[model samples]
Structures are given as structure tokens and as C-alpha cells.
Target: MIEAIIHGVILAFGLILPLGVQNVFVFNQGAIQPTFLRAVPVVITAAVCDTLLILLAVLGVSLFILTFAWLKTVLFGIGFFFLVYMGWVIWRSEPLKVNEAEATSFSPKKQILFAASVSLFNPHAILDTIGVIGTNSLGYSGEEKWVFTLATIIVSWIWFMGLALAGRSLGKLDSGGGLMKRINRFSALVIWGVAVYMLTKI
Candidate 1:
């Protein structure tokens, strides 16, 4: 059980450490929101999406679904375009002001929708959860498998909250807008880079 938990933590963290589109969006939302509490929707939505994916992967459902070649192609096409659009939006985002009005802030619905898109539309994320985590689970069963799944799920939730907190800290430091602009540009690049990679795979 200990070994399974350790493997889960290490593997989940390793996969999530990359600055992918989903992570970047979560961090950006945290930085843009006036307060950490206001970023809860984004954090929760992302975590929930990951949880669902992890559960499906562990149950072997994702593998069965992905077995169809046409479905994979369709997913790749949708993900590629969605990522490109998101990248453009981020790149063109105006610099956030310290005193930005609440009226201009993203509504909870928008936040949830955007978070879901970032989390669910990425083929890489799906594959990582299904291909990597699912394949790893093949070695464990019953209690061990449950322990491993729980560990990964816990790590995912904690990591999302931690990222939001870190972004909140950075937001405080970025009152001058310089740092914020740079971060946005870098995030856009990361999103675009992932889109390009996906395009190549398709």
C-alpha cells in the first residue's frame, strides 16, 4: 500500500509538473482574480475534471473509449483548435489593473466553463491520465489500486490549490503589470507549443 501510494504521488506530480495549458489557465485565473477565494471555482472545476478522468482511467473506461481510432482523431481535431483559440485569447489579453472592477471579472459560469475546457479538451491530459496512470494501475489490484488512486486524486486536488495560492502571491507582486504581461505571454507560448505538438501527432 505504501509503495502504491508513493508511486501514485510521484507519477501524478511528475505528469502535472509540466506547464501545460490547463495549469497555465488555472494560474492565470488565480492571478487575475481579486482574491484567492474568488478563484475557487476555477480550482474546483479543474480538480473535479481531473478526478473524473482519474476515476475513469482507473476503472479502465477511458481505455475502452479511446480504442476507437475515429474518436481519437475527432478529439485531436477539437483539442487542437480549442488550444489555438485559447492561446490567442491569452496572448491578446490586456494587462490587468490592480483596481480592476468586479464587473469586469469573469463570472462563475465563465470560469467554470473555461476551466472545464482547459481540463477536458486537452488530449495530452486525457492520455496521461488514461495511458500513464491507467497502465501503471495494471500492476495493482483491490486495496492497492484504491490506495494508489486515492493518492493521485489527493495530490491533484492539493496541487491545484497550491498553484492558485502561488499565483495569488505572484499577483500581489505584479501590481506594476510588467510581471503579469510577461507571465501571460509565456503562458500563451506554452499553450501554442502544446497545440503544435498535438497537431504533429495528428
Candidate 2:
């Protein structure tokens, strides 16, 4: 049981540690929001989406879905285009000042919508997530499987909150928003690169 917990933690961090669109967006919102509370919608939405995916993967639902080749292809195509659009929108957006954040920052509704879109549609997140967890979970069963699954879920929630906290620290330091501007463009480029990679798969 202890081994299962450790394995789950390690595997989850290994999968989530790499750069990805979902991570980038969450961090970006954390840095631009007027306060930590303002970023709660994004953090919650992303965490929830990840939890749902993890549960499905561990339960064998994802494996059943993967049996359809066309479904995978269709998902990839949609993810690719969504990433492209997100890249463009993020690239052009300027980070807002604390005084201006209320007027210009992403509202809670927009944040939830975008967070859900990136979380649900990003094939990179889905494939690697479901593929790895679903396969690894095959090693455990019953209570042990659930324990492993819980450990991974905990890691994911903590990681996103940490990312947001780190971003909030940066946001406080970058009062002029110059650093965030560069980050936004760089994030957009990273997103586009992922989109291109997804394009190749489709």
C-alpha cells in the first residue's frame, strides 16, 4: 500500500512536471489576476478536470474509449485547432495592472470556460494522462488501486495550487507587468509548438 502511494506520487509528478498548455495557462492566470481569490475559478476548474480524467483512466473507462481510432483522431484535430486559437489570443493579450485588472482581466466565467477547454480538449494532457495512469494502474487492484489513485489526485491538486502560488509571487514582484508580457508571448509560442506537434499526429 505504501509502495502504491509512492509510485502514484512519483508517476503523477513525472507526467505533470513537463511544460504543457494547461500548466502554462493556469500559471499565466495566476500571475495576471488582481488577487489569488480572483484566480480561484481557473485553479478549481483545472483541478476538477484533472480529477475526472484520472478517475476515468484508473477505472478502465479511458481504455474502452481508446478502442475507437476515429474518436482519437477527431479529438486530436479539435485540440490542435483550439491550441492554435488560444496561442493567438494569448499572444495579443497584455497583462493588466492591479488597478485595471477588474476592467480587463479574465472574468470568472471566461476563466472557467477557457480552463475547461484547455483541460478537456488538449490531447497531450489526455493521451499521456490516460495512457500512463491506465497502464500503470493495471499493476494494482481494489483498495491498493484506489490508494494509488488518491495519491495521484492529491499530487495534482497540490501542484496546480503551488504553480498558482508561485505565479502570484511573481505577479507581486512584476508590478509593471513587463515580465508577464514576455511570459505570455513565450507561453503562446510554447503552446503553438505543442499545437504543431499535435497537428503532426492528426
Candidate 3:
């Protein structure tokens, strides 16, 4: 069981280490958004998705997602197109134009929904959760598999939550909007680069 948990953590770390589209988007949001509070939903959604895919893998259902070459190809195409579109949107998006008046009326729910959509539909996330984490579950037994899956989910939550919260704490150095815009632009480029890498891999 201990070995299985360790294996799951290591696998989770490896998958999360890559600069996926979600990482770029979340980091961008953290830098540009008024409050770090906006990122909680994104973290939760990502973590839940990770757990679901891991469970499917443990149940031996993920093999079908991989075995169908035509399906994989189709998903790959759809995902690639969407990623490119999203990357363009993120790149072209205006940076940190938050109106203080509007900020007072801002809804956390809307931000969460946005975060959820971004995390859930992300192409790299689909592959990582359904392909890497899902397939890796086969190495463990019943309880060990459970432990492994939970640990994987924990990694997602911790990393994303940290990013979201960290942005708030770090916002101090950049009191002016100028620094935030630079960070947003930099993160957008990172996202664009990652999206392209994913497309080529597919």
C-alpha cells in the first residue's frame, strides 16, 4: 500500500510537472484577476476530474479510450483545434482591465464556472487524466488503487490551489497595474507555447 501511494505521487508529479494548458490559464488568471479567491473552483474541478479518470483506469475502462485509434485521432483533432482557438483568445485578451466599480460587484460563482470550463475542456488535461493517470492505476490492488487515486487528486488540488493563492500573496510587489500586465502577457505566451507543443504531440 505504501509503495502504491508512493508510485501514485511520483506519477502525479511527473504528469503535473509539464506546462499544460491549464497551468498557463490558471497562472494567467492569478496574475490578472483581482483576487486569488477566483481560483478555488478551478482547483476543485481539476482535482475532481483527475480522481474520476484515475477511478476509470482502476476499473479497466480506460483501455478502450486508448485502443480505438480512430477515436483517439478524432479527439486529438477536436482537442487540437480547440486548444489553438483558446490559446489565441488568451493571447489576444486584454490584460488586467478590472474596473474597481465592477470588482465590488464581481461574482465568485462566475469565476468558478470559468475556471471549471477551462480546466475541464483543456486538451492536455484530458490526456493526462484519462491517458497517463488512468492507465497508471493498473499497477495497484484494490485498496492500494484507492490510495493511489486519492494521492493523485491531492497533487492536482495542492498545485493549483497553491498557484491561485500564491498569486494573491505575491501581488504586493506589483502595486501598479503595469507589473500585472507584464505577468499576464508572459503567462499568455507560455500558454501559447504549451498549446503548440500539445498539438505537435497529438
Candidate 4:
């Protein structure tokens, strides 16, 4: 069980370390939002989506879903289009041009919607969750299996909260908004790159 917990923690961290669209959006919201609490909707939504993915993967449901070639194609297609659209939005988000607070302040509904989109719509994220975490969960059984799953879920929640906190801290420091604007552009490019990569995979 102890080994299971350690394995889960390391695996979760490894899988999430990449600069994926989901991570970038979460961080972006944290940095742009007027306050830390304002970023909570994205954080919570992301965490919940991850939790859902982890559960589906561990329960073997995701593995079953992955067996369908058509499903993968659909995922890749939708994800590619979504990333392209989202990238454009991020690139154009000029907090300084419009009323700074009003421009950056996404409603809770929008936050949740975007958060879910990045989490669920990204085929790479889904594959990682299903292929990596799901495969790993097979190594244990009964209590150990569940312990591993719980550890991974906990790590995900903690990592997202930490990211938001880091973003909030940086937002406080970037009063001029210059650095954040650069980040938005850079983030958009990264997201577009991911979209292209997905198309190649398809």
C-alpha cells in the first residue's frame, strides 16, 4: 500500500509536468483573475475533471473506450479544433487594452466551461490518463489499488492549487501587465502547436 501511494504520486507528477493546454489555461486564469478566489472555479473544475478521468481510467472504463478507433479519431479531431479556437482566444486576450479588470475577469460559468474543455477535450490528456494511470492501476488490487488511485487524485488537486497560488503571486508582481501579455501570446502558440500535433497524430 505504501509503495502504491508513492508510485501514484510520482506517476501523477510525471504525467502532469508537461506544459499542456490544461495546465496553461489554469495558470493563465490564476494570473489574470483579479483575486486568488476568482481563480478557484477553474482550479476546482480542472481538479474534478482530472478526478473523473482518473476514476474512469482506474476502473477500466477508459481502456474500453480506447479500443474504438473511431473514438480516437473523433477525440483527436475535436481536440484539434478546440485547441485552435482556444489558442486564438488566449492570444487576443488583451487585459490592458480593455478595462483591465473587466477584460480579465471571466465569469464563473466561462471559467468552468473553459476548464472542462481543456481537461476533457484534449486527446493527449485523455490518453495519458487512460494509458499511463490506467495501466499503472493494474499493478495493484483491492485496497492498494484504491490507495493508489486516491494518491493520484490528491496529487492532482494539490498541484492545481499550487499552480493557482503561483500564478496569483506572479499576477501581483506584474502590475504593468507586460509580462502577462507575453505569456498569453506564448501560451497561444503552445496551444496551437498542440493542436497541430494532434492533427498529425490523427
Over 1-202, each residue of candidate 2 has an lDDT whose tens digit, in order, gives 9999999999999988988988999999899888899888999999999999999999887887688888878888888888888889889998876566576457889888778878887786688778889889999999999999999999999998988888888988988989999999999998899889888877
- For every candidate in turn, the CA RMSD to the true structure comes to 1.6, 1.2, 3.3, 1.8
Q: Which ten residues in a row have the lowest lDDT in candidate 2?
A: 96-105
Q: Residues 110-152, candidate 4: write the lDDT tens digits.
A: 8898788888878767899877899989999999999999999
Candidate 2 matches the true fold with a TM-score of: 0.95
Task: Give residue 187's lDDT in candidate 3 (0 to 100).
Answer: 63
- Residue 157, model 2: lDDT of 95
Best by TM-score: 2
- Model 3: lDDT to the true structure: 0.64
Better of 3 and 4 by lDDT: 4
Q: Rank the candidates by lDDT, best first.
A: 2, 4, 1, 3
Off by over 4 Å in 1: none
Q: How accurate is candidate 1 locally (lDDT)?
A: 0.85
Q: Once superposed on the true structure, which residue ranges of model 4 sit more than 4 Å away at CA?
A: 96-105
The candidate with the higher TM-score, 1 or 2, is: 2
Q: Rank all candidate structures by their TM-score, best first, as comma-separated numbers.
A: 2, 4, 1, 3
Q: Candidate 3 residues 83-176, lDDT tens each?
A: 5665565556555544431352124564454455445455556667777777777777778889988888788778877776666565545556
Deviation in angstroms for 38 in model 1?
1.6
